[model samples]
Target: MITLDSASNNNTAMEELEELFIEELMDLLNGIPELTVIFSADESAAELKEYAEALQSDPVGKSRQIVAACRASGQRRADVKQIIVDGNRKFLWQPGGTLRVVQLLRDCETRWSSTYLMSDRLLELYPAVQCFLNHPQQTQIAHLLFTTPQYQLLHDIQTILAVPHAAQELLSAEKTPTLSAALPAFEILLESWIDLQTKLPMLSHYIGVGIVKIQEYAAKGRKTRAYALAMSIVILCGVTFIS
Candidate 1:
């Protein structure tokens, strides 16, 4: 075992000896990439490439902005929350209405899963929200509510992100896992994405770009694995011959 703590080595002779070992170890690993580099390569190769920038990206951010602007921007005096509550309450009490009232869920910056929940809730409450904004009492928030195109954008985003959000939740469990679990999960995701290509053209384009980058990294991983297997076989053969 080696100790690198400066305070633990008070002896002058030992300090000089430790410096020599440190220098030799550094020279020995001079060409090796750091852990951060290896981790980044793995991220770029895996499904992580799909959501690496999701926190700051437009789909999640823009959806949040649209909802927030309803209460804070444009005419600015409307109690958007009260309007939604009243509208949903009215709808729930209406004849032939059996569904429970659902409130809009805001996305929290620290919780990534909230983005998907927010979009899903917005879509579910769309009709009620539209009704509230259109009513005479909701003058201020009407213009602030998302326009037709903006709502469409949010819907598409929510639909596409559902897959990743579900996968994230499934993967985040604390249970012990194996490498074999990843391929099936990724295959399912890829198949679902391929089916959504026509339904979500914009999302398809973004996914296509990420797929290209991931493919390049995956090719590199394959070559590395092949080389390692070959080296292992050669080493085993030599060891057997020596024995």
Candidate 2:
């Protein structure tokens, strides 16, 4: 019924109003301390305030609330529209399309968490270990040695500690007895891993934490490859540092 793309006189006017409303909603959504402004064809201040407050409790809850309220308030379907995003919720909507009704919501802001990021980063470092260790002479592993300044020392410590855990993983996976990570013979040079850890803020603390985590996770999973991989990284780091 509502065609914003129409070339007709009345249709053009309605389309302009809809465009204005949509732009306003986008502005309110993007603003810091996020603003919730509701618009309606009737231009009822009380209704707008009520809708705003309802959204504040659960921004996307407007689906059920707005639909039910509109019915009671004698508001038509075309009278209202809202664009609600949970901080980072992504979607694309166009004017005069199917009604977007919110059923449930969660504030989708990604927490800048040190622990989660550190763990994820360590996992990312896993694949490179084998490459560096296998061909220490040919590979350039200096970049892989240190953590960025963004991390705490705890992250670094975890990285250093991950080697032993990775080693343990291999030992557990092997149908036959395998090498131990802590054994003096097996403790390959960890210069690169140490270098990476030192780049982080709280180097010593994060390294301590990382070591403990590697110990924990390495206990269950296949670790032979993990051990060999870790050993390779340690050795490569050491070799790269020497040169």
Candidate 3:
């Protein structure tokens, strides 16, 4: 027989949900398992080190400045909006149309994938963006043009982040993921990240820092696995003694 429990950490809403609904199901079944598989790292803390939030800070801030400049004028904003729309239309109708043009995606604090998608889309729209900013009508927003360093930063951020984004996609499948999958996936992810540093010399610093963070999390995972194994052995010994 398998027992499943829906317990939560200290979040107030989750606590309330667990008390109200999850507890009812737990009572109906029996109780939760002593050890539950924890998938994924604590994102709130781990994200700062693993992802491009740090790398993209300047670019995102610069992008926001562009938004602010465009919003300052109705005509400027309209022109910018029209440019994006035209790009989308061109994307669909152009003879050698690559793919559908994705809109400017906002990065969410909670979702790392949003950062990747946002950077990717921004890179795709770079040429159109350059034209719009350089246009005489867009003189006010000219100062907001993305710089060489900023473009390079976004490119590096997207490449390094793609690995974790892919891993997250694999782990978050609708089907139940096994605990064994985490370690191997992480190992491969770690190696890929390390290899990226060598390939992109400019990105070496961020990738190096990220590798250290991943190692820390991997160490914690190993300890948690060892502790669980020890406890399981102890429980088995107790069961044999009782028998």
Candidate 4:
């Protein structure tokens, strides 16, 4: 069994290894006729990470601008953190304080979930971010402040990315990683993106693209016996538990 990421080099390596296993090793070890090599890729991680990178490069929308603004804001995390904390403190001492202070999150280039987290935190602290940037002393980064429409676009981007982000997190469970979870996660992501296409017309193009990418990966995953067997075992366990 071989597991790899969806890189071109890895794909090439898998193909060559499979050929070796079939043409050379199979004959050499003819006694082990039932033996076979299982080649699997981390489709969930690949899809989410590639989708984020592709979205950032898309020319059709303000996603790139929104990400850039968030990245710029993160560059001044200390100042933003102080602003949010002070604002929260003001409400804390008030009669009916309901505000919770949230620090601005910075996205890592390699992780799609971080991008979602940063965008989510930014949207959550929108008012505080605006106030911080609007201050006279903060004029340097004032230009990085998001406009009303840009904020809406940012929200849309966040919404679109949420499905895959959640799927990635679920599949990345530290204690109970299971292949049975992959197909369902892909299905959920496909359903969410298709639904988003209808709900967010402005992002229909990107969402449509995402739907196709997920479908492609899902189809590939369905061909794997390990995935099928894992899902079957999960179903059996569920039935037993219910009974």
Give per-residue CA lDDT, model 2, range 1-243, as digits (tens): 111111333322222322333344344444532233333334454343433333233312222232233233223222222222211134332232232342222111232122223344333332232222234452333233322221222233345434544443444454432432333312332343445556642233434343444445444323457666666776765632232
lDDT of 1 at 82: 56
Per-model CA lDDT versus the true structure: 0.50, 0.34, 0.54, 0.57
Candidate 3: clashing residue pairs, number:
0
Root-mean-square deviation of each candidate, in angstroms? 18.9, 26.6, 17.4, 16.2
What ranking of all candidate models by TM-score puts the best one first? 4, 3, 1, 2
Instruction: Give the Å error, residue 26, model 3.
Output: 54
Per-prediction TM-score to the true structure, in the order listed: 0.52, 0.21, 0.57, 0.61
Worst 10 residues of 2 by lDDT: 103-112
- Candidate 1 C-alpha lDDT tens digits along 168-237: 5554556434122333444555567677877765356555543454345444545676545644665665
| Better candidate number, 2 or 3, judged by TM-score | 3
**Across residues 118-186, which tens digit of lDDT does each residue of candidate 3 receive?**
557666766666767899877766887766655775566567767876766665666443343455667
**2 versus 3: better lDDT goes to:** 3
- What global local distance difference test value does model 3 have? 0.54
- Provide the lowest-lDDT 10-residue window in model 1: 1-10
Clashes of each: 0, 23, 0, 0
Cα deviation of 219, candidate 3, in Å = 2.2
Pairwise TM-score winner, candidates 1 and 4? 4
Candidate 4 residue lDDT tens string, 109-174: 445355457667667776766776688977775776655544655566667767766776677677
- Count of clashing pairs, candidate 2: 23
| lDDT: the better of candidates 3 and 4 | 4
